[model samples]
Target: MKTRNQKGLESKYWLLIIVAACILCMAATFFAGVKSGPVRVIADYTVVPMQKGINVIGTWVNGVADNFVTLKSVQKENKTLKEQNANLKMENNQLQQKAVELERFYDLYKMDQNTSDYPKVGARVIANDGSNWFTSFTIDKGSADGIREDMNVLSGNGLVGIVTKVNAHSSTVRSIIDEVNISSMIMTTFDQCIVSGDLKLINNGVVKFEQLANNENEVAVGEQIVTSNISSKYLQGLLIGYVSEVNVDSNNLTRSGYIIPAVDFKKLQEVLVITTTKQDLIDNGNQTQSDSSEK
Candidate 1:
Protein backbone atom coordinates (compact mmCIF):
# COMPACT_ATOMS: atom_id res chain seq x y z
CA MET A 1 0.00 0.00 0.00
CA LYS A 2 2.81 2.39 0.83
CA THR A 3 4.67 1.64 -2.53
CA ARG A 4 1.48 2.04 -4.49
CA ASN A 5 0.90 5.41 -2.93
CA GLN A 6 4.44 6.54 -3.72
CA LYS A 7 4.10 5.41 -7.43
CA GLY A 8 0.82 7.29 -7.76
CA LEU A 9 2.29 10.43 -6.27
CA GLU A 10 5.31 10.22 -8.67
CA SER A 11 2.96 9.78 -11.68
CA LYS A 12 0.89 12.81 -10.62
CA TYR A 13 4.02 14.94 -10.25
CA TRP A 14 5.25 14.07 -13.85
CA LEU A 15 1.81 14.80 -15.28
CA LEU A 16 1.76 18.18 -13.62
CA ILE A 17 5.26 19.01 -14.90
CA ILE A 18 4.27 18.04 -18.55
CA VAL A 19 1.13 20.22 -18.30
CA ALA A 20 3.14 23.21 -17.04
CA ALA A 21 5.76 22.82 -19.87
CA CYS A 22 2.97 22.69 -22.53
CA ILE A 23 1.35 25.80 -21.06
CA LEU A 24 4.70 27.69 -21.00
CA CYS A 25 5.40 26.74 -24.66
CA MET A 26 1.95 27.98 -25.77
CA ALA A 27 2.51 31.26 -23.92
CA ALA A 28 5.91 31.75 -25.58
CA THR A 29 4.35 31.21 -29.04
CA PHE A 30 1.63 33.79 -28.29
CA PHE A 31 4.23 36.30 -27.03
CA ALA A 32 6.35 35.82 -30.15
CA GLY A 33 3.32 36.41 -32.40
CA VAL A 34 2.44 39.58 -30.57
CA LYS A 35 6.03 40.83 -30.76
CA SER A 36 6.07 40.19 -34.49
CA GLY A 37 2.89 42.35 -34.90
CA PRO A 38 0.45 39.60 -36.10
CA VAL A 39 3.09 38.23 -38.52
CA ARG A 40 2.36 40.98 -41.18
CA VAL A 41 0.94 38.44 -43.63
CA ILE A 42 2.53 39.53 -47.04
CA ALA A 43 0.55 38.12 -49.98
CA ASP A 44 2.58 40.16 -52.61
CA TYR A 45 4.99 37.31 -53.47
CA THR A 46 2.58 34.28 -53.68
CA VAL A 47 -0.67 35.90 -54.87
CA VAL A 48 0.99 37.90 -57.71
CA PRO A 49 2.62 34.71 -59.23
CA MET A 50 -0.73 32.85 -59.10
CA GLN A 51 -2.58 35.72 -60.80
CA LYS A 52 0.12 35.99 -63.53
CA GLY A 53 -0.13 32.29 -64.23
CA ILE A 54 -3.88 32.53 -64.62
CA ASN A 55 -3.51 35.50 -67.02
CA VAL A 56 -0.93 33.66 -69.14
CA ILE A 57 -3.15 30.58 -69.41
CA GLY A 58 -6.12 32.70 -70.41
CA THR A 59 -4.09 34.60 -73.06
CA TRP A 60 -2.73 31.35 -74.55
CA VAL A 61 -6.22 29.80 -74.79
CA ASN A 62 -7.66 32.96 -76.36
CA GLY A 63 -4.85 33.12 -78.92
CA VAL A 64 -5.44 29.48 -79.94
CA ALA A 65 -9.19 29.99 -80.30
CA ASP A 66 -8.70 33.17 -82.38
CA ASN A 67 -6.22 31.38 -84.67
CA PHE A 68 -8.65 28.53 -85.29
CA VAL A 69 -11.46 30.95 -86.19
CA THR A 70 -9.19 32.96 -88.52
CA LEU A 71 -8.02 29.77 -90.27
CA LYS A 72 -11.59 28.67 -90.92
CA SER A 73 -12.47 32.09 -92.35
CA VAL A 74 -9.47 32.05 -94.68
CA GLN A 75 -10.37 28.60 -96.01
CA LYS A 76 -13.93 29.68 -96.72
CA GLU A 77 -12.70 32.78 -98.56
CA ASN A 78 -10.30 30.71 -100.67
CA LYS A 79 -13.09 28.34 -101.74
CA THR A 80 -15.33 31.26 -102.70
CA LEU A 81 -12.57 32.87 -104.73
CA LYS A 82 -11.96 29.62 -106.59
CA GLU A 83 -15.61 29.33 -107.52
CA GLN A 84 -15.70 32.94 -108.69
CA ASN A 85 -12.66 32.38 -110.88
CA ALA A 86 -14.27 29.35 -112.53
CA ASN A 87 -17.43 31.33 -113.27
CA LEU A 88 -15.44 34.19 -114.79
CA LYS A 89 -13.57 31.76 -117.06
CA MET A 90 -16.84 30.29 -118.31
CA GLU A 91 -18.22 33.76 -119.05
CA ASN A 92 -15.08 34.73 -120.92
CA ASN A 93 -15.29 31.63 -123.14
CA GLN A 94 -18.94 32.37 -123.98
CA LEU A 95 -18.09 35.95 -124.89
CA GLN A 96 -15.27 34.78 -127.16
CA GLN A 97 -17.55 32.38 -129.05
CA LYS A 98 -20.14 35.13 -129.50
CA ALA A 99 -17.51 37.48 -130.87
CA VAL A 100 -16.41 34.89 -133.45
CA GLU A 101 -20.01 34.34 -134.63
CA LEU A 102 -20.59 38.07 -134.91
CA GLU A 103 -17.50 38.44 -137.06
CA ARG A 104 -18.68 35.70 -139.45
CA PHE A 105 -22.08 37.32 -139.77
CA TYR A 106 -20.54 40.68 -140.50
CA ASP A 107 -18.44 39.19 -143.30
CA LEU A 108 -21.52 37.55 -144.81
CA TYR A 109 -23.47 40.81 -144.65
CA LYS A 110 -20.74 42.74 -146.43
CA MET A 111 -20.49 40.11 -149.15
CA ASP A 112 -24.24 40.24 -149.72
CA GLN A 113 -24.23 44.00 -150.11
CA ASN A 114 -21.43 43.84 -152.64
CA THR A 115 -23.21 41.46 -155.05
CA SER A 116 -26.76 42.84 -154.99
CA ASP A 117 -27.40 43.03 -158.77
CA TYR A 118 -25.73 39.76 -159.78
CA PRO A 119 -27.15 36.35 -158.87
CA LYS A 120 -24.20 35.91 -156.58
CA VAL A 121 -23.24 33.06 -154.27
CA GLY A 122 -20.64 33.11 -151.52
CA ALA A 123 -18.24 30.19 -151.45
CA ARG A 124 -15.38 29.15 -149.18
CA VAL A 125 -12.12 27.91 -150.74
CA ILE A 126 -11.61 24.35 -149.74
CA ALA A 127 -8.41 23.21 -151.51
CA ASN A 128 -5.66 24.64 -153.73
CA ASP A 129 -3.84 22.67 -156.43
CA GLY A 130 -0.21 23.10 -155.34
CA SER A 131 1.02 23.87 -158.86
CA ASN A 132 1.86 27.15 -160.52
CA TRP A 133 0.94 25.88 -164.00
CA PHE A 134 -2.65 25.00 -163.05
CA THR A 135 -3.23 27.62 -160.30
CA SER A 136 -6.72 26.44 -159.40
CA PHE A 137 -8.72 26.30 -156.19
CA THR A 138 -11.85 24.35 -155.19
CA ILE A 139 -14.90 26.20 -153.87
CA ASP A 140 -17.57 24.77 -151.62
CA LYS A 141 -20.44 25.94 -153.88
CA GLY A 142 -21.16 23.91 -157.04
CA SER A 143 -24.07 22.95 -159.33
CA ALA A 144 -26.35 22.72 -156.30
CA ASP A 145 -25.69 26.42 -155.65
CA GLY A 146 -26.34 27.45 -159.29
CA ILE A 147 -22.63 27.46 -160.04
CA ARG A 148 -21.74 26.57 -163.65
CA GLU A 149 -18.67 26.36 -165.85
CA ASP A 150 -17.24 29.68 -167.17
CA MET A 151 -18.86 31.67 -164.33
CA ASN A 152 -16.71 34.63 -163.35
CA VAL A 153 -15.43 34.48 -159.74
CA LEU A 154 -14.64 37.71 -157.91
CA SER A 155 -13.25 38.34 -154.48
CA GLY A 156 -13.93 41.33 -152.29
CA ASN A 157 -11.18 43.29 -154.00
CA GLY A 158 -11.61 42.29 -157.66
CA LEU A 159 -11.65 39.37 -160.12
CA VAL A 160 -10.15 36.13 -158.78
CA GLY A 161 -10.74 33.43 -161.39
CA ILE A 162 -13.26 31.64 -163.63
CA VAL A 163 -15.14 28.48 -162.85
CA THR A 164 -13.75 25.70 -165.10
CA LYS A 165 -15.32 22.52 -163.75
CA VAL A 166 -18.16 21.80 -161.34
CA ASN A 167 -18.91 18.75 -159.25
CA ALA A 168 -22.01 18.03 -157.25
CA HIS A 169 -20.79 19.90 -154.17
CA SER A 170 -17.74 21.82 -155.33
CA SER A 171 -16.31 23.75 -158.30
CA THR A 172 -12.77 24.43 -159.50
CA VAL A 173 -11.56 28.00 -160.16
CA ARG A 174 -8.89 28.59 -162.83
CA SER A 175 -6.93 31.58 -161.57
CA ILE A 176 -5.69 34.27 -163.97
CA ILE A 177 -2.15 33.27 -163.19
CA ASP A 178 -2.53 30.03 -165.13
CA GLU A 179 -0.49 29.64 -168.31
CA VAL A 180 -3.55 28.95 -170.47
CA ASN A 181 -5.13 32.40 -169.75
CA ILE A 182 -4.11 35.54 -171.64
CA SER A 183 -4.70 39.16 -170.57
CA SER A 184 -4.60 41.71 -173.42
CA MET A 185 -3.57 45.29 -172.81
CA ILE A 186 -3.00 48.72 -174.44
CA MET A 187 0.01 50.59 -173.10
CA THR A 188 -0.57 53.70 -171.01
CA THR A 189 1.86 55.29 -173.47
CA PHE A 190 1.21 55.67 -177.22
CA ASP A 191 2.06 51.91 -177.70
CA GLN A 192 -0.24 48.85 -177.86
CA CYS A 193 0.90 45.46 -176.55
CA ILE A 194 -0.41 42.10 -175.40
CA VAL A 195 0.44 40.57 -171.99
CA SER A 196 0.66 36.80 -172.08
CA GLY A 197 0.80 34.37 -169.13
CA ASP A 198 4.00 32.34 -168.72
CA LEU A 199 4.15 29.92 -165.78
CA LYS A 200 7.94 29.57 -166.07
CA LEU A 201 8.64 33.09 -164.76
CA ILE A 202 5.52 33.21 -162.56
CA ASN A 203 7.47 32.37 -159.39
CA ASN A 204 7.82 36.16 -158.91
CA GLY A 205 4.07 36.63 -159.66
CA VAL A 206 4.72 38.31 -163.02
CA VAL A 207 4.09 37.58 -166.73
CA LYS A 208 5.70 38.45 -170.07
CA PHE A 209 4.25 41.00 -172.52
CA GLU A 210 5.40 40.37 -176.09
CA GLN A 211 5.09 42.29 -179.41
CA LEU A 212 5.05 45.82 -178.01
CA ALA A 213 4.44 48.56 -180.61
CA ASN A 214 7.34 50.82 -179.59
CA ASN A 215 9.98 48.20 -178.80
CA GLU A 216 12.76 50.68 -179.76
CA ASN A 217 12.29 52.63 -176.56
CA GLU A 218 12.27 50.42 -173.45
CA VAL A 219 9.09 50.40 -171.37
CA ALA A 220 9.32 52.32 -168.11
CA VAL A 221 8.98 50.56 -164.75
CA GLY A 222 5.94 51.14 -162.47
CA GLU A 223 3.55 51.51 -165.42
CA GLN A 224 0.07 50.14 -164.62
CA ILE A 225 -1.15 47.17 -166.74
CA VAL A 226 -4.88 46.67 -167.22
CA THR A 227 -7.07 44.29 -169.24
CA SER A 228 -7.49 45.51 -172.83
CA ASN A 229 -10.83 46.71 -174.18
CA ILE A 230 -10.64 44.03 -176.92
CA SER A 231 -10.20 41.22 -174.42
CA SER A 232 -12.91 38.63 -175.20
CA LYS A 233 -13.04 37.09 -171.72
CA TYR A 234 -12.00 39.72 -169.15
CA LEU A 235 -13.48 43.16 -168.67
CA GLN A 236 -11.63 46.27 -169.79
CA GLY A 237 -9.59 48.44 -167.32
CA LEU A 238 -9.38 45.60 -164.80
CA LEU A 239 -6.03 46.06 -163.01
CA ILE A 240 -3.79 43.09 -163.96
CA GLY A 241 -0.41 43.99 -162.46
CA TYR A 242 2.38 46.57 -162.27
CA VAL A 243 5.36 46.67 -164.63
CA SER A 244 8.52 45.62 -162.79
CA GLU A 245 11.18 44.71 -165.41
CA VAL A 246 11.50 45.07 -169.23
CA ASN A 247 13.54 42.90 -171.56
CA VAL A 248 14.07 44.05 -175.16
CA ASP A 249 15.62 42.27 -178.15
CA SER A 250 18.76 43.57 -179.82
CA ASN A 251 16.83 44.52 -182.99
CA ASN A 252 14.17 46.29 -180.80
CA LEU A 253 11.28 44.53 -182.61
CA THR A 254 9.80 42.69 -179.64
CA ARG A 255 9.92 43.24 -175.82
CA SER A 256 8.85 41.41 -172.65
CA GLY A 257 8.64 42.38 -169.04
CA TYR A 258 7.75 41.19 -165.55
CA ILE A 259 4.30 41.99 -164.14
CA ILE A 260 3.51 41.61 -160.44
CA PRO A 261 -0.10 40.38 -160.16
CA ALA A 262 -2.52 42.48 -158.11
CA VAL A 263 -3.89 39.63 -156.01
CA ASP A 264 -1.98 37.55 -153.49
CA PHE A 265 -3.03 34.03 -154.46
CA LYS A 266 -1.67 32.41 -151.27
CA LYS A 267 -4.06 34.21 -148.95
CA LEU A 268 -7.31 33.67 -150.91
CA GLN A 269 -10.22 32.85 -148.59
CA GLU A 270 -13.72 34.17 -149.47
CA VAL A 271 -14.82 34.91 -153.04
CA LEU A 272 -17.86 36.18 -155.02
CA VAL A 273 -19.38 34.81 -158.23
CA ILE A 274 -20.61 36.93 -161.12
CA THR A 275 -23.60 34.89 -162.32
CA THR A 276 -25.45 37.67 -164.18
CA THR A 277 -25.25 37.31 -168.01
CA LYS A 278 -25.77 41.02 -168.80
CA GLN A 279 -23.75 42.32 -165.88
CA ASP A 280 -21.80 44.87 -167.94
CA LEU A 281 -24.96 46.18 -169.63
CA ILE A 282 -26.73 46.46 -166.29
CA ASP A 283 -23.79 48.30 -164.77
CA ASN A 284 -23.66 50.77 -167.70
CA GLY A 285 -27.43 51.37 -167.58
CA ASN A 286 -27.33 52.07 -163.88
CA GLN A 287 -24.51 54.54 -164.36
CA THR A 288 -26.40 56.31 -167.15
CA GLN A 289 -29.61 56.42 -165.11
CA SER A 290 -27.76 57.90 -162.18
CA ASP A 291 -26.22 60.58 -164.39
CA SER A 292 -29.64 61.46 -165.89
CA SER A 293 -31.23 61.69 -162.47
CA GLU A 294 -28.44 63.91 -161.16
CA LYS A 295 -28.79 66.25 -164.17
Candidate 2:
Protein backbone atom coordinates (compact mmCIF):
# COMPACT_ATOMS: atom_id res chain seq x y z
CA MET A 1 0.00 0.00 0.00
CA LYS A 2 2.78 2.42 0.87
CA THR A 3 4.55 1.64 -2.43
CA ARG A 4 1.31 2.33 -4.36
CA ASN A 5 0.89 5.69 -2.61
CA GLN A 6 4.51 6.65 -3.40
CA LYS A 7 4.05 5.77 -7.08
CA GLY A 8 0.86 7.87 -7.31
CA LEU A 9 2.65 10.88 -5.78
CA GLU A 10 5.50 10.52 -8.34
CA SER A 11 2.93 10.45 -11.17
CA LYS A 12 1.46 13.78 -9.94
CA TYR A 13 4.92 15.36 -9.77
CA TRP A 14 5.65 14.35 -13.42
CA LEU A 15 2.24 15.76 -14.52
CA LEU A 16 3.10 19.13 -12.87
CA ILE A 17 6.47 19.24 -14.65
CA ILE A 18 4.75 18.48 -17.99
CA VAL A 19 2.30 21.35 -17.46
CA ALA A 20 5.13 23.75 -16.61
CA ALA A 21 6.96 22.72 -19.79
CA CYS A 22 3.81 23.30 -21.89
CA ILE A 23 3.33 26.80 -20.41
CA LEU A 24 6.93 27.70 -21.25
CA CYS A 25 6.52 26.42 -24.79
CA MET A 26 3.37 28.61 -25.21
CA ALA A 27 5.26 31.62 -23.89
CA ALA A 28 8.06 30.99 -26.36
CA THR A 29 5.57 30.61 -29.23
CA PHE A 30 3.93 33.96 -28.32
CA PHE A 31 7.32 35.67 -28.21
CA ALA A 32 8.71 34.06 -31.43
CA GLY A 33 5.35 34.28 -33.18
CA VAL A 34 5.17 32.33 -36.50
CA LYS A 35 8.95 32.07 -36.44
CA SER A 36 8.48 28.98 -34.16
CA GLY A 37 7.10 27.29 -37.31
CA PRO A 38 8.08 23.59 -36.86
CA VAL A 39 7.03 23.48 -33.12
CA ARG A 40 3.59 25.00 -33.84
CA VAL A 41 3.00 22.69 -36.80
CA ILE A 42 3.91 19.57 -34.82
CA ALA A 43 1.65 20.55 -31.88
CA ASP A 44 -1.35 21.21 -34.17
CA TYR A 45 -0.99 17.83 -35.91
CA THR A 46 -0.64 15.69 -32.72
CA VAL A 47 -2.86 17.45 -30.14
CA VAL A 48 -5.98 17.97 -32.28
CA PRO A 49 -6.27 14.31 -33.31
CA MET A 50 -5.64 13.12 -29.73
CA GLN A 51 -8.43 15.38 -28.36
CA LYS A 52 -10.90 14.16 -31.04
CA GLY A 53 -10.11 10.51 -30.22
CA ILE A 54 -10.82 11.17 -26.51
CA ASN A 55 -14.24 12.74 -27.35
CA VAL A 56 -15.22 9.74 -29.53
CA ILE A 57 -14.31 7.26 -26.75
CA GLY A 58 -16.44 9.23 -24.21
CA THR A 59 -19.51 9.12 -26.53
CA TRP A 60 -19.22 5.30 -26.96
CA VAL A 61 -19.06 4.78 -23.17
CA ASN A 62 -22.21 6.90 -22.64
CA GLY A 63 -24.07 4.92 -25.31
CA VAL A 64 -23.16 1.60 -23.63
CA ALA A 65 -24.51 2.83 -20.26
CA ASP A 66 -27.85 3.90 -21.83
CA ASN A 67 -28.31 0.56 -23.57
CA PHE A 68 -27.68 -1.33 -20.29
CA VAL A 69 -30.55 0.60 -18.63
CA THR A 70 -32.94 -0.18 -21.49
CA LEU A 71 -32.07 -3.89 -21.39
CA LYS A 72 -32.95 -4.10 -17.70
CA SER A 73 -36.40 -2.62 -18.30
CA VAL A 74 -37.13 -5.08 -21.10
CA GLN A 75 -36.06 -8.05 -18.96
CA LYS A 76 -38.42 -7.02 -16.16
CA GLU A 77 -41.42 -6.76 -18.50
CA ASN A 78 -40.68 -10.15 -20.07
CA LYS A 79 -40.63 -11.79 -16.65
CA THR A 80 -44.05 -10.34 -15.77
CA LEU A 81 -45.64 -11.54 -19.04
CA LYS A 82 -44.22 -15.04 -18.57
CA GLU A 83 -45.80 -15.33 -15.14
CA GLN A 84 -49.18 -14.19 -16.46
CA ASN A 85 -49.08 -16.71 -19.29
CA ALA A 86 -48.42 -19.56 -16.87
CA ASN A 87 -51.39 -18.52 -14.72
CA LEU A 88 -53.68 -18.42 -17.76
CA LYS A 89 -52.69 -21.92 -18.86
CA MET A 90 -53.48 -23.34 -15.42
CA GLU A 91 -56.94 -21.70 -15.41
CA ASN A 92 -57.74 -23.05 -18.87
CA ASN A 93 -57.01 -26.65 -17.83
CA GLN A 94 -59.37 -26.38 -14.85
CA LEU A 95 -62.19 -25.02 -17.01
CA GLN A 96 -61.79 -27.83 -19.53
CA GLN A 97 -62.12 -30.48 -16.78
CA LYS A 98 -65.28 -28.84 -15.49
CA ALA A 99 -66.78 -28.82 -18.98
CA VAL A 100 -66.26 -32.59 -19.35
CA GLU A 101 -67.92 -33.33 -16.00
CA LEU A 102 -70.89 -31.13 -16.83
CA GLU A 103 -71.43 -32.97 -20.11
CA ARG A 104 -71.46 -36.31 -18.26
CA PHE A 105 -74.17 -35.13 -15.85
CA TYR A 106 -76.30 -33.86 -18.73
CA ASP A 107 -76.15 -37.26 -20.40
CA LEU A 108 -77.25 -38.97 -17.17
CA TYR A 109 -80.29 -36.72 -16.90
CA LYS A 110 -81.38 -37.49 -20.46
CA MET A 111 -81.15 -41.24 -19.83
CA ASP A 112 -83.31 -40.90 -16.75
CA GLN A 113 -86.00 -39.06 -18.69
CA ASN A 114 -86.05 -41.61 -21.52
CA THR A 115 -86.57 -44.61 -19.19
CA SER A 116 -88.94 -42.91 -16.75
CA ASP A 117 -91.62 -45.60 -16.96
CA TYR A 118 -89.37 -48.45 -15.78
CA PRO A 119 -88.07 -48.82 -12.24
CA LYS A 120 -84.42 -48.69 -13.26
CA VAL A 121 -81.06 -49.14 -11.59
CA GLY A 122 -78.26 -46.80 -12.65
CA ALA A 123 -74.73 -48.25 -13.00
CA ARG A 124 -71.39 -46.82 -13.93
CA VAL A 125 -69.11 -48.76 -16.25
CA ILE A 126 -66.12 -49.89 -14.22
CA ALA A 127 -64.25 -52.21 -16.52
CA ASN A 128 -64.04 -53.00 -20.22
CA ASP A 129 -62.69 -55.85 -22.31
CA GLY A 130 -60.46 -53.28 -24.11
CA SER A 131 -61.67 -54.55 -27.48
CA ASN A 132 -62.73 -52.33 -30.37
CA TRP A 133 -66.34 -53.07 -29.36
CA PHE A 134 -68.41 -52.73 -26.20
CA THR A 135 -69.13 -56.44 -26.49
CA SER A 136 -68.54 -57.10 -22.79
CA PHE A 137 -68.09 -54.71 -19.89
CA THR A 138 -68.62 -54.74 -16.14
CA ILE A 139 -70.86 -52.26 -14.37
CA ASP A 140 -70.88 -50.94 -10.78
CA LYS A 141 -74.27 -52.53 -10.03
CA GLY A 142 -75.07 -56.27 -9.80
CA SER A 143 -77.29 -58.88 -8.09
CA ALA A 144 -77.29 -56.82 -4.92
CA ASP A 145 -78.88 -54.01 -6.93
CA GLY A 146 -81.42 -56.39 -8.58
CA ILE A 147 -79.46 -56.68 -11.85
CA ARG A 148 -80.21 -60.13 -13.26
CA GLU A 149 -79.46 -62.16 -16.38
CA ASP A 150 -81.32 -61.14 -19.58
CA MET A 151 -82.34 -57.80 -18.09
CA ASN A 152 -82.49 -55.18 -20.86
CA VAL A 153 -79.91 -52.41 -20.52
CA LEU A 154 -80.37 -48.93 -21.97
CA SER A 155 -78.15 -45.91 -22.41
CA GLY A 156 -78.98 -42.28 -22.94
CA ASN A 157 -80.66 -42.60 -26.36
CA GLY A 158 -81.77 -46.24 -26.63
CA LEU A 159 -81.20 -49.92 -25.85
CA VAL A 160 -77.62 -51.03 -25.18
CA GLY A 161 -77.51 -54.73 -24.37
CA ILE A 162 -78.55 -57.43 -21.90
CA VAL A 163 -77.05 -58.36 -18.57
CA THR A 164 -75.30 -61.69 -18.99
CA LYS A 165 -73.60 -62.34 -15.64
CA VAL A 166 -74.12 -60.84 -12.22
CA ASN A 167 -71.88 -60.83 -9.15
CA ALA A 168 -72.60 -59.63 -5.66
CA HIS A 169 -71.53 -56.07 -6.46
CA SER A 170 -71.28 -55.84 -10.26
CA SER A 171 -72.85 -57.22 -13.42
CA THR A 172 -71.43 -57.93 -16.88
CA VAL A 173 -73.31 -56.65 -19.93
CA ARG A 174 -73.08 -58.21 -23.38
CA SER A 175 -73.72 -55.26 -25.66
CA ILE A 176 -75.85 -55.64 -28.77
CA ILE A 177 -72.65 -55.36 -30.80
CA ASP A 178 -71.49 -58.73 -29.51
CA GLU A 179 -71.20 -61.40 -32.17
CA VAL A 180 -73.37 -63.82 -30.22
CA ASN A 181 -76.36 -61.50 -29.83
CA ILE A 182 -79.42 -61.05 -32.10
CA SER A 183 -82.38 -58.71 -31.97
CA SER A 184 -85.82 -58.57 -33.61
CA MET A 185 -86.82 -55.13 -34.76
CA ILE A 186 -89.64 -53.47 -36.71
CA MET A 187 -89.43 -50.48 -38.98
CA THR A 188 -91.61 -47.42 -38.60
CA THR A 189 -93.96 -48.95 -41.18
CA PHE A 190 -94.32 -52.14 -39.11
CA ASP A 191 -92.06 -54.15 -41.43
CA GLN A 192 -90.14 -56.84 -39.55
CA CYS A 193 -86.36 -57.56 -39.66
CA ILE A 194 -83.69 -59.44 -37.70
CA VAL A 195 -80.74 -57.41 -36.39
CA SER A 196 -77.62 -59.27 -35.39
CA GLY A 197 -74.19 -58.25 -34.12
CA ASP A 198 -71.19 -58.65 -36.44
CA LEU A 199 -67.64 -58.41 -35.10
CA LYS A 200 -66.35 -57.11 -38.44
CA LEU A 201 -68.84 -54.21 -38.50
CA ILE A 202 -69.00 -53.35 -34.79
CA ASN A 203 -65.81 -51.33 -35.06
CA ASN A 204 -67.52 -49.17 -37.67
CA GLY A 205 -70.45 -48.31 -35.33
CA VAL A 206 -73.02 -50.39 -37.18
CA VAL A 207 -74.67 -53.81 -36.86
CA LYS A 208 -75.98 -56.35 -39.41
CA PHE A 209 -79.70 -56.43 -40.31
CA GLU A 210 -81.35 -59.04 -42.48
CA GLN A 211 -84.58 -60.96 -43.07
CA LEU A 212 -86.33 -57.69 -43.80
CA ALA A 213 -89.77 -58.42 -45.30
CA ASN A 214 -89.54 -57.80 -49.05
CA ASN A 215 -92.90 -56.26 -49.61
CA GLU A 216 -94.30 -52.92 -50.82
CA ASN A 217 -92.83 -51.44 -47.60
CA GLU A 218 -89.71 -49.41 -48.39
CA VAL A 219 -86.79 -49.65 -45.93
CA ALA A 220 -85.00 -46.39 -46.63
CA VAL A 221 -81.79 -45.21 -45.10
CA GLY A 222 -82.19 -43.26 -41.87
CA GLU A 223 -85.43 -45.04 -41.00
CA GLN A 224 -85.61 -45.78 -37.28
CA ILE A 225 -85.91 -49.42 -36.20
CA VAL A 226 -87.24 -50.35 -32.78
CA THR A 227 -87.83 -53.54 -30.83
CA SER A 228 -90.84 -55.32 -32.34
CA ASN A 229 -94.06 -55.86 -30.43
CA ILE A 230 -93.50 -59.63 -30.62
CA SER A 231 -89.98 -59.54 -29.15
CA SER A 232 -89.58 -61.64 -26.00
CA LYS A 233 -86.66 -59.89 -24.24
CA TYR A 234 -86.58 -56.28 -25.48
CA LEU A 235 -89.43 -53.90 -24.78
CA GLN A 236 -91.57 -52.73 -27.68
CA GLY A 237 -90.86 -49.26 -29.11
CA LEU A 238 -87.33 -49.29 -27.64
CA LEU A 239 -85.09 -47.86 -30.34
CA ILE A 240 -82.42 -50.25 -31.53
CA GLY A 241 -80.89 -48.41 -34.47
CA TYR A 242 -81.47 -46.66 -37.81
CA VAL A 243 -81.30 -48.31 -41.22
CA SER A 244 -78.09 -47.38 -43.00
CA GLU A 245 -78.07 -49.65 -46.10
CA VAL A 246 -80.83 -51.70 -47.69
CA ASN A 247 -80.80 -53.95 -50.76
CA VAL A 248 -82.75 -56.95 -52.00
CA ASP A 249 -80.95 -60.30 -51.99
CA SER A 250 -80.54 -62.50 -55.13
CA ASN A 251 -83.44 -64.64 -54.02
CA ASN A 252 -85.71 -61.55 -54.02
CA LEU A 253 -87.46 -62.88 -50.93
CA THR A 254 -85.76 -60.62 -48.36
CA ARG A 255 -83.69 -57.45 -48.01
CA SER A 256 -80.50 -57.08 -45.94
CA GLY A 257 -78.77 -53.94 -44.64
CA TYR A 258 -76.72 -52.28 -41.92
CA ILE A 259 -78.05 -50.34 -38.96
CA ILE A 260 -76.36 -47.50 -37.05
CA PRO A 261 -77.04 -48.30 -33.42
CA ALA A 262 -78.71 -45.74 -31.13
CA VAL A 263 -76.13 -46.24 -28.38
CA ASP A 264 -72.67 -44.83 -29.03
CA PHE A 265 -70.99 -47.93 -27.67
CA LYS A 266 -67.51 -46.48 -27.81
CA LYS A 267 -68.41 -43.73 -25.40
CA LEU A 268 -70.31 -45.79 -22.87
CA GLN A 269 -69.69 -44.77 -19.28
CA GLU A 270 -73.03 -45.11 -17.47
CA VAL A 271 -76.07 -47.30 -18.21
CA LEU A 272 -79.57 -48.09 -16.90
CA VAL A 273 -80.97 -51.57 -16.21
CA ILE A 274 -84.69 -52.20 -16.54
CA THR A 275 -85.74 -53.91 -13.30
CA THR A 276 -88.26 -56.02 -15.21
CA THR A 277 -86.92 -59.28 -16.66
CA LYS A 278 -87.79 -61.39 -19.73
CA GLN A 279 -90.03 -63.59 -17.54
CA ASP A 280 -92.08 -60.47 -16.90
CA LEU A 281 -92.86 -60.30 -20.65
CA ILE A 282 -93.80 -64.06 -20.80
CA ASP A 283 -95.96 -63.39 -17.73
CA ASN A 284 -98.00 -60.73 -19.59
CA GLY A 285 -95.69 -57.76 -19.23
CA ASN A 286 -94.76 -55.45 -22.13
CA GLN A 287 -91.04 -56.24 -22.89
CA THR A 288 -89.66 -59.51 -24.34
CA GLN A 289 -86.40 -60.98 -25.64
CA SER A 290 -85.58 -61.73 -29.27
CA ASP A 291 -85.44 -65.35 -30.45
CA SER A 292 -84.50 -64.66 -34.07
CA SER A 293 -82.00 -66.80 -35.94
CA GLU A 294 -79.28 -65.71 -38.37
CA LYS A 295 -80.14 -65.59 -42.11
Give the winner by TM-score.
2
Give the range where candidate 2 is weakest over 10 consecutive residues by summed lDDT: 286-295
Per-residue accuracy of model 1 over 176-242 as CA lDDT, tens digit each: 8776555556456535567766666777667777666544554678787766655556655556677
Instruction: Compare the candidates by lDDT and give the number of the best one.
Output: 2
Task: Please give the CA lDDT of all the candidate structures.
Answer: 0.70, 0.81
Residue runs of model 1 more than 4 Å from their true location after superposition: 1-119, 130-134, 186-208, 215-222, 247-249, 276-295
lDDT of 2 by residue, 1-295 (tens): 9999999999999999999989966665454444456766765566546557888999999999999999999999999999999999999999998897678767767877866777787889998899856779999998888888989888877888888899999999988888754556665688877888887897777888898878998777899988876676777677888888898988999999898999888888878889887677676432222323321
Model 1 / residue 243 / CA error / Å:
2.7
TM-scores of all models? 0.52, 0.70
Model 1 local distance difference test score: 0.70
Q: Which residue pairs collide in model 1, if any? A: none
